[model samples]
Target: MNQASSTTTSGSAAGMHPREFVAFIAALMAVNALGVDLMLPALADMGAQLGVATANHRQWIITAYMLGFGSGQLVYGPLADRFGRKPILLATLAGFVAASVFAAGSQTFAALLGARVLQGLMSASTRVLAVAIVRDRFHGRQMARTLSVAQMIFFLVPIMAPTLGQLLLNTLGPWRFIFYALAAFAAFVLAWSSLRLVETLAIERRGSLSIAALGSAYRLTLTNRFSAGYAIAAAMTFGGIIAFVSSAQQIFVEEFGMGDRFTYLFAACAFAMGVASFANSRLVERLGTRLISQAAVLALIALSVGHIAVILLGVESLVSYMLFQALSMTCIGLCGSNFGAMAMEPVGHIAGTASSIQGFITSVGAVIVGSLIGQSYNGTTLPLAIGYLGIGIAVLGVVLVVEEGRLFHARQAP
Candidate 1:
C-alpha cells in the first residue's frame, strides 16, 4: 500500500482520531441530506418564485436531483477506484460548490432544476467515496458499527436543516439565499476535506480505467448473490424513508395541521432515528446485523399496518401519527447501516464499484417510490402509510431470500 493509503488503513487519517474520521465522513455524506431536506421548508416559496403552477410539480425539483444523483454514482465509483478517494472527492466537492452557486442565482424553474441536477451529480461522490473509504478501513460488523456511528452523526443534519432553512427563508427574504447558504457550506466542507482527508485507495489496488475493467467490476458487484440481494432489500427500505421525506412537509403541515411546528416535529422524529443509529452502533457487534435488521423491518411492517388501521378507523390523531412515524424512523435507522454493511461485506475487493452500484440502485428506486408516494397525497396519510407497509414487507422478502429463508441467524462478527 502507498503511504497515504497505509495511513488511512491504520485507523486514522491525517492524524485525525477515529471519532473525527467518523464525523468528517458523516459531514460529507450529510451534504446529500442537506441538499434534499434543507429545501423542504423553501419548496413553496421556490415554486412561487419560479412560477410553478401545480403543487405536485414542485416535487420535480427533488426528483431531478435524485435522478442525477443516482446516475452520477455510476461514473464516480470507477473513477474513485481508478484514481484515489481524496482527489475524486475534492474534485466533486468543487463541482458541488459551483453547482450550488449556480442554483442560488438561477432565475427560472428550468435553470434551477438544471442546477439541482448538477449539484446532485457532484454530491454523488460524497456518498460513493465515503462508503468506499469506510470499506477501505473496516469490514464486516466493524464496518456496520462504524457506518452506524457515521449515520448517527449524519442524522443531525436532517434534524436541523429544515429549521435552519425556514429561518433563512424568513429572515433572508428569499429562497435563493438557502442555495447560497448551501454553497457556503459546501465551500467549507471542501476546504476541510482538502486540508485533512488522506487518500484511502492504494495505488497498487487501484483498478484500471478501461471499459473492460469497469464492466468486470460492475459485473462482479451485480452477480454476487449476497451483495445483490442485500442491496435490493436495502433499496426497498430506503424507498420507504425517502417517501416519508418527500411527503413529510405536506403530511405534517397540511394533513395534521402542524403548520410552523412541522420543523420541530420532523426534527423530533429524526432524533429518534439518530438515537436508534447510536444504539445500533453499540449493539451491532453483539446482536449482529441480520438479527437487528430483521427485527427492525418486522417492527416497521407492524407499525405501518397499525398506523394505516388507525387512519381508517378515524382515530389518527396528530399524536398517534407522530408516535407511529417516530417508531418507523427508528426502525429504518436500525436497518439502514446494517443492510449497507452486509451488502458490501462480500464485495470489498471492488468497494468503489460496489458502493456506486448499490447507491445507484437504492437512490433511483427510492426516488421513484418516493415520488409515487409523495404525489399520492390527497390531504390524507393513507398513501404514506400504505407505502411504508408495502415496502417494508417487500424488504423482508428480499432479506429472506438473501439469507435463504433464515431471518435471525447470527454469524460470527468479523
Candidate 2:
C-alpha cells in the first residue's frame, strides 16, 4: 500500500488495498456503535449514581446523543464538502475526545447527558465521512458490496463492545471510566487516520460554500424521487434497529432475568447480524442490492409477525425472544448497506450534502420512533416486537414507492 503524502491535489488512497480501506472505514464508523453499545452495561450503575428518578429516564443518555448526532450531520456534510474530508474528520475526532473527557468528569445526570450529546455531535463526522469516502471511490452494486464488507467488520464492535463494557465495569468499578476509555479509543483512531487517510474530494469538484449553493443542493436531493424514496425506506428500517438497541438491555435483564448474562445474549444477536452482513457482501454482487434488500424486508416482516404471535400466546421465553430477535437483526443486516448504497447511487456529485440530508432524516426519524418504542417498555417484549413489525411494513411501502411498485428489478448499469 502506498502511503498518502500531504502534497497531492486530487486525493488518492495512497495505494491502499480494498481490504485495508474497508477495515479503516469500518473502524471509523464502528466508533458510533461503540459509543452507544458500550454504555448499555453501565446504564443502571450510572443512573443510580447520578440520581436518575426512574429506570426509563436513564434512556435519555442514549437519546440525547442520537439527537445531537443526527443534527450535527447537517453541519458536517456541508463543511466536509467545502473544506475537504481530512481536516473536518480530524477536527471532529479531537472534539469527540474532549467531549468524552468532559462526560467522564460529569457530576450530574444532566451534565453527563450534555457531554454525551457533544460527543455524538463530534462523532457524526466519522459516520458521514465514512459513507462519503465509499461513495467517492465506488458507485452502484460495487458500492453496495464494499459497504457490506465494511459493515460486516463494523458489526464486530457491537458484538464485543457490551462484553468489553461489562469487563471494564467489573474491573474499574466505576461507569465513568468507560467514558475515559472512550476518549482513549477516539484518540487512537484520530492519530491513525491523521497519518494514513488522504483527502478524497478534489478541489475543483467541490461545491460552493454559499447559502444559495447549499439551497440548490438540498433542493436537488429532495426532489430526486429515487434518493428521497430510498431515504424514507432506509429511515423506517433503521428505526426498527434503533428500537431494538434502545430496548435490548431492559428486555434481557428485566424481562427475562438474564442478569449479567445479558451481554452475551446481546452478542449472540450481533453475531447473527455480522454473519448476515458477510453473506450480503458475497451475495450483493450476484443478486443486486434491490433484490437482496427487498427479500430481506419481507423476511423481517415475517419474523416480526411470528414474534408478536408468540408473545400474545403467552408462549414467549427468553430463548424464543432471542431466536426471533436474531432473525430480525439478520434481515436488518442485509438491508442497511444495500439501501444506503441505492439511495446515494445517483447523488455522488453532491455526495457530502446528499449524505448529510439523508443521514439527518434517517437518524432523526429513527430516534423519534425508537424513543417512542423504548419509552413504552412495560417490562415485556411486546412493544419491541410490534415496533419491528410496524417499521418493516412501513419501509416496504416506501420501497414500493421508490421502485414505482416494481420489486426486485435491477436498474441499468452506470
Candidate 3:
C-alpha cells in the first residue's frame, strides 16, 4: 500500500490511487451526518419517552446540535491550520464519543439535548477537516471532481442512516440505544483515523490564528464577489436540507400520519435525493457547476410552487405531497456538492478557515433559518415549500451575483 501522499494530483487524477483518498474523505464528510441521520428515527419517540411535551421543543434536539456544530467550526478550522488537522480531529472525536455516551444515558430530553450539543460541538471538526482535506490534496477541477465523488459516497448516510436507526429503535426497544450505536461508530472512526491519518496541513504553511484570520477569511471570501456569491448560494440551497433535518421526522410521523413507518419513508426520500446527488457529481464538471445549479435552482422552484399548488388544489394524500417533496430534494443532490466546491475554490490560503466559515453559515445559520422555516408548519406543506421558494430565490439571486448576470443569460460564471 502506498502511504506516500502526493499533493500534486489533478482531477480524475491518475497514479494517485483515488480509492483510499476517496474513502478517507467520504468518511470525514459522513461523520457529522451519522449524528444527524442516526438520531432521526428516534426524534418523535425520544421526545415522548424523554418527557418532551409540546412537539415544537423536540425540533430543538436537531437544531441545537447543528447550532453547536456551526459554532465549533470557527475554532476547529483555525486550530487545524495553526496546530494540525490530525490532532484537532482526534480530539474532537473524543469529545463526540464521550458526548454520545452522555446522550445515551441521559434521563430526560433536555439532558439528551445537552449531550447532543456537545457531540455536535466537537464533531464540527470532522466536517471542516473533510473539506480542508480536499484543499490539501487537489485544486481546481481536480478538487471539484474529488469532492463530488467523495460527496456522492458521503451522501449515502441520508439514504440508510434513518433506516438503520429505526432498526436499532425496534430491536433495542428505546431511542437512547441509537446514541449507543453512535458512540460505537464514532469510536471506531476515531481509532481508525488515529492509526491511518497523516498531517494534511503543512506546519510551516499556517498563518497567525488571531481573530484577524477569522475576520480576514470572512473578508477575503466576501470581498471576492464570485466566492461570496457561491458561498451564499451554497448556504441558501443547503439550508433547505437543514430545514428538513429538523422537521422531517415530525412531518412524517406527526403531520403526515405515517406512524412508525416514518423511518422507512424518510429513508426512501433520502435515498432518492442521494442518488440524484451521486449522479450530479458525475455530470457536474461536464455540465459546469453554474449551468447545473441554474437548472437545479429552477427545478427546485418549480417543485416548491407545484407543492403549494397541489395542496391548495385538494391533493391531500401523503403520496401526493411526498412525491413533490421527493422531487424537490433531487435539486439538493445537485446544489450541496457543487456549491460547496465553488465556494471553497477562491480561499485557498485559508482553506481550513474558509471551510469552517462555510460550515458555520450552513450549519449554524441554517439552524436558525431552518428552524424558523420548520416552526411555521401548519399541518400543510406550504411552510416547507414556502421555505424552499424563498431560499430558492435567494439562491438564484446569489448565483446571479456570482455569475454577474441574470439566470441562464450568464454566458460564463465569473
Q: Give lDDT per model, in order.
A: 0.87, 0.87, 0.78
**Candidate 1: minimum summed lDDT over ten consecutive residues — where?**
6-15
lDDT of 2 by residue, 1-414 (tens): 122232132335433566778988898988788888898999889898999979888888888989888888998889989988889999999999999999999999989999989988999888889998888777788888888899999999989999999999999989998998899999988987888887788776678889899999899878887777787788787777777777888889998899879999999999988999999999999999989999999999999999999999999999899899999999988888988888887787888999999898878887898898889999999999998998889988988887778898987423
Model 1 lDDT per residue over 45-112, tens place? 88888899987788888888988898899888888888988888988999998999999999999999
Which window of ten consecutive residues has the lowest lDDT sum in model 3?
1-10
Off by over 4 Å in 3: 1-6, 9-17, 211-215, 408-414
Error of 3 at 316 (Å): 3.2
In model 1, which runs have C-alpha deviations exceeding 4 angstroms?
1-14, 411-414
TM for candidate 1 is 0.96
> For residue 384, what is the lDDT in candidate 2?
90
Candidate 2 lDDT score relative to the true structure: 0.87
- What lDDT tens digits, residue by residue, belong to model 3 across residues 1-414? 111244543223322246877887788778788888887877777887888877777888888888889889878887777887788889889888899999989997778878878988988998899888778776655667777788778778887898888789778988878888888988888887887776766666676778876688778866877666676777676778878877887788777889767877877777767777677767766766767778999899888888878878887578986787777788877777777777777786688878887778777667767888988876667788889989888888778766766665424333
Error of 3 at 329 (Å): 0.9
